[model samples]
Target: MFKAFVKIAVLLSLTASMAFGYQAIRLNVSEGTYKERNDAFNGILEVDLEDAGFTPKDIHPKIEYYYKLFYGTKLLKDGKPNPQFKTDYVGNLDNLGFITISNEEWMRELLMKEPKLGSFAPLNYLIYKKKSEDKTYVGTLTPQAMLDIAEIKDAGVRAAFTEKIDALSDATDEGMGGEVEYVEIDKLPAKTLIEWEIPFDRGEDVLDAKFDFMEKFEKAFEAEEYIIAGKRDFAEYWVDNDLENDKYDAYWVYSLCHFTFSYTVFNVWEHPELGASAPCSMYMYLDKDSSTLKVGMPSVDNWAVFGKITDPKRLQFIKDMDSKIKEIMTSLGAKEI
Candidate 1:
C-alpha cells in the first residue's frame, strides 16, 4: 500500500508541474544581422490575450499601444539592445516603457511558479509585452519636443523687447538730465499673439495723424491701374515694367496704410538692386483690415538702425537714396499719396 501511494503522489506532482509550466509564446522576431547595411529587418509573433490570462476590459482602452523587445547576439550601434531584434507586443498588450524585472529574476519566478514548463534559458531576449490596455495617449518627450516647449516658455522676442525698453529709459534720463514722466499702455489694436505696445507720448495725436494719412492714401491708389490678387484684407498687386535697364520685370506686392507697413510681402526678383526703392507710381493706404497700426509714439522709425541695420555704409546709402527719391517725387508733383 505504501509503495502504491508513493507512485500516485509522484504522478500527481508531475501533472501539476506540467499544467502550471505551460506558457504560450507571445511574440518572436529576428532583427539585424547585416553588417554592411545599417538598416535592420523585423519579424513578429503573438499569442492570444485570453491565453495570457488577460481580460477584454484590460485590452480595450490601450489598443494603439506598442512595445518593442530586443534579443539575439547582435547589438545596437549604441551598444544597447541588438538593433536587429525588434519585436512587437502580442495579445493586445501596450508597451509601458521597460519592465522592472531583471532577466534572472524573471526566469526564476517563471520556473518556480510553473515548474512543469521546461527551462526558459534558451529565451534570451528583450520582452515588451503589454500589461494592460486602458492607457492614455499622452505624447512622448523627445529632445526636440522638450526644446520647443522650453522656447515657448522663454518667449525670447518679448524678453528682448523688454530689455530694449529699459535701455531707452536709461538713455532718456541721461540725455534730458531729468527722469521723464511716463505711462505704459499694456494693450493695443491689431496685435499678434507675440506683439504688444506701449505708447510713450501724444498717443491720440499720433494715431489720428496716421489714420488720416492712411485714409487719403487708400483713396489715391484706388485706380484700376494695378492687377489685384488675394483678398481685400490681404492682397498683392503686380505691375509690368517697360524699362529695359530695370532689373525687375514686374513689380508685385501689396501695400497697406499708405506704404507705412506691408503685411504681405511683394516679390520682385528681377532687380535685386531696386529691392529697397521707394514706391514708384505705387502707393498704399491703411484700410479697416490694417486697423492694427493704431497711433503709438511712431514706433521709433530708427528702430532698424538701432536694432538691426548693422552696416553704416549701407545705412547712409539708404538715407541718401531716400533723399534723392524725395527730390524726384517733388519734381514729378508726386506728393505723399
Candidate 2:
C-alpha cells in the first residue's frame, strides 16, 4: 500500500509540474535507442530546434565516452590497475551529451535589455538515455525558472522568453515522443546564478585584447583542472549566417566541467538523467563600445534541485563548485555585480 501511495505521489508531482510549467528540469522520455528513434533526440537536433530558431553552436556530441577517461584517471591515480577497476564499465548511459544552443535573433533583440539572459542564451539542450530504463530523456531547464534565477523583472521579456522555450519544447515533442517528466522540486534554491564582470582595455584592436583575455581565462581555469569542453562565438555566428547582430562587438559562450566532480555525481551515484544539466554554461559578452566583459552562469546549486539531490555531502560539493567558480572569476580581476 505504501509503495502504491508513493507511485501516486510521484505521478501527482509530475502532473503538477506539467500544469505549472516550471519544475526544476523539463524532460521527455521516449522508449528506444538513438537509431530506433531515427536519430531523434532530442532529434540529434540539427533540424527541429534549429529550424525553430534554437540554433546549436557548440556540441559535446558524445559524453558517455567518459568511461575511457575514467579508466585513465584510475590507472594514473592508483599507479596500477586493480581488478575491481572495470576499464570497460561505461555505467548505465547508452547516449549522453551537452549541446549548447541559442536563438540568435531573439537574443539579439533581448540581450541589450537583459544581458543576464545570456546565462541561458546558449543553454544546455541536453540529451541522454539510460540503458537500465530503455528510455531517452531530452530537455533543458525551464525558462520561467531561468527568469526567476536570473532575477529578470521585465514581464515582457519573461513572456517572450518562455514562449521561445515553449516553441523549443514543441520541437522536441515532434522529434521525440513519450510522457513528460520533472524533478519533484517546486521552488528554486536560495541562490540561482553566479555573475561577474572584469574591465579590460579594447586597445588599438578590439579583437587583440579580447583574444588575450580569453587565452588567459582558459589557462586560469585549466590550472584549476576544469575542462573547457566547448565554446561558441555568437558574434561570428551572426556575421557568417548574415544575421543582424551589431549590438555586441564580441560575445562568447563556454562550457565548463570539472571531470572528477561530474564523474562523482553522475557516474558514481548513477543519476545519468542529470546529464541534462551537465557542463555549465559561462557566457562572456562585451557590448558595442563597452570595455567590460560580463560573465554569468546558473549556479551549481540549481543542479541539486534538478536531481532532487539529498545527500548532505553531495549538496555541499555542489555548493562549493559555485564558490570555486566565483573565486576563479575574482582571481582574474572580476568583480561580482
Candidate 3:
C-alpha cells in the first residue's frame, strides 16, 4: 500500500511538472492580534494610488469591497447547517475576513479582452486570528500570479496592473506590519477557462422575456444542486449612479453556491480563508459592437492550486465543479470556445 501510494504521488508530480504556468505570491504577516469584526475595528487605510498620476477611479470609483466572514461565529450560532458544525470548537482561530480590492474599470476592461484574467482580479487579502496564537496573518494573492494565470501578453497593461497592485500591497503590508514572503512553486497546475458563447442580436434583453438564456442558465445549475445566492448588476448600478453610463451595454455577475460543497470545503475542510473566492462568480456581458453575448469564468481549479490543495480527492472535486459549469453553459445554448 505504501509503494502504491508513492507511485501515484510521483505520477501526479510529473503531471504538474508538464503544465506549470503560474505560482502564488503570498504576503504573510505572522505578528498581530485581531478581535472579532476586524473589518469594523481595523479601519481602512487610505492610500494614494493616483498620486503618481494614475486614475483607478475611472473604472469604478468604489475601490475596496470589504466583508467579514465570521466562520467561527456562524458555526457557533447555527449548528444545523452540517454535522461538523456541532463539533466542539477547540481551535485557536476565532475570526477571519476576505478583503477584495480592485479598480473595476481598469480590471474589467482588461478582463473583457481576456476573460481568463478574471481569476485574480478583485484581489483578495485574507485576515485571520488563531485563538491559541496571538499573531494574526494578513496575506494576498500576488499580482504576478494573476498575470501569469491570464497569460497576459501585453507588456504595457501588465506593467500598469502590476504597479497598481504593488501600491496596494505596500499599503497592506505597512498596515499589517508584516514582512513579505512568497510561497511559490516552479510549476503551476492546469487552469481552465469555462467559457461559452451565446448568439444574441439584442444584448439588453438577454436576461429579459425576449430570451431564455437567463432562465436556462439558472435551471441548469439548479438541476446540478447549485443555488443562486444572489446577483449583482453592475450596469444597473452605473446607470442609476450616473457613473460610466456608456461603458457597458449590459453587465452582471452571478453568485453561485452549492450548500453541500460549501459545507465540505468551509466547515469540514476548515479553510474559511478560501472564502476569499466564495460565492463563485461567473460574469456575462455584451459588447456594444458585438451581437454575441460573451460569458465566462475562471476555473475553480485555480483556487485549488493557489490554496495549495494537493489532495487528489479535493482537486477532482474542483475539476468536477468546472465541468459542471461548462455543462450549464452549453445547456444554455452557449458553445464552448
Give one digit per residue, the lDDT tens place, for model 1 in 264-300: 1111111111111112212122222233221111111
Relative to the true structure, candidate 3 has a C-alpha RMSD (angstroms) of 10.0
What number of backbone clashes does candidate 1 have, counting pairs of residues 3 or more apart or in separate chains? 15
Quote each prediction's TM-score.
0.16, 0.83, 0.67
Could you report the Cα RMSD, in angstroms, for every candidate shown? 33.1, 5.7, 10.0
Report the Cα lDDT for candidate 2.
0.76
Query: Using TM-score as the measure, what is the rank order of every candidate, best first?
Result: 2, 3, 1
Candidate 2 or 3, higher lDDT?
2
Q: How accurate is candidate 3 locally (lDDT)?
A: 0.56
* Candidate 2 Cα misplacement greater than 4 A, ranges: 1-15, 18-22, 42-44, 72-90, 239-247
Q: How do the residues 62-160 of candidate 3 rate in per-residue lDDT, one tens digit apiece?
A: 111111122223343455543333234233345555444444555555654555454454444566554556765555556666676656777776887
Q: Pick the candidate with the highest lDDT.
A: 2
TM-score of 1: 0.16
lDDT at 181, model 2: 71
